[model samples]
Target: MYKAACLVLALFAVALAVPSTYDTEHVWKAGNLSYVVPDNAVLGGFDPYGFNTYVGRVIYANSILPARVVVETGVAYFNTETLSSKLLVYDILVAERNVNYVWVRSFDGFYEKGAVAVGTTNKNERVFCCRAKTDGGVLIGTLLLSQKLCIIKHETLALRKFDKYEVLVAQAKGNGTLY
Candidate 1:
């Protein structure tokens, strides 16, 4: 009986040592859109100097018909030299209503406020919009789709129209490549 109990305890300890996976679910009622990040979607690793790093891809879909509309790939890194963590998001592609567009909001390092929006073939139709803040981390933003535009600011969600004055800013400050 003592040996059996010891074996059970060892197995439990091993299970507890394993890292837990992340699963995210986001919903937008006004746009009838839902974004799901499945468990084990992100793969993590360590650099030669023992810095932590992760890479993942997230797919956004329409709730009603369950069609894929957007895909985003992001990379997160923890630098031991600076003792800081940073996330770099790349390849934000949107496909809706038979129209496809690429959003250019890629940023390397950390940022306080960033916004990216993509529209369909029609000039007045907006497919989606994403806002990122350092306080809340990544994957925390409002997703607008299907002709509906929603804006989430400071945790308050509102349905609003796309601003015509909004512009896309691409700043290349360092010697890094822009994709």
Candidate 2:
């Protein structure tokens, strides 16, 4: 009886030690640019780093009212350039391993599929979604990887198609998103 009780206690402790990926403290990543949704008037703000800049570090999403995300045909994009939409809400449809299927709430209070587009640019680069059905394929949080988080794929988390630019979920350093 003591052994069984001890085992249950041990298992409970281990489970508590596991961190949840749904934690909003972690920011989104695409290539070298950390997606930092600011808590300002801008709906969707860009990183201080230029589109071609690589800061070589993780930038947190430090906003209480970050820009709302819109997913069209599995591709994700921001509704506006500012972060003031009360209708913008996100929910994790499913969580697997260290990854999760992130769903964005719609204007009608419905969640839609969110995804990343790879190689949208003719140069075989760029992670953001621009055109539809280009060489730059759409990636989804619904897609799972069998290997390490490298090489952004049709269902990957990284930003670029290839190279060292990997998409990953970055945890904030204390000063992160409230939600």
For candidate 1, write residues 48-156 as lDDT tens digits: 3333322222222211111111223233222111122333422222222322122334322212122222322122322233333322332222333442322322223
lDDT of 2: 0.25
- Point to the candidate with the largest lDDT: 1
RMSD of each: 19.1, 17.1
Tens-digit per-residue lDDT, 80-166, candidate 2: 121112222332111233433222322211111333322111122222212111123322211112221222222222233221222
User: Looking at candidate 1, what is the lDDT of residue 7?
Assistant: 100
lDDT of each: 0.28, 0.25
Clashing residue pairs found in predicted model 1: none
Clashes of 2: 10
Off by over 4 Å in 2: 3-19, 26-70, 74-134, 137-149, 155-161, 166-179
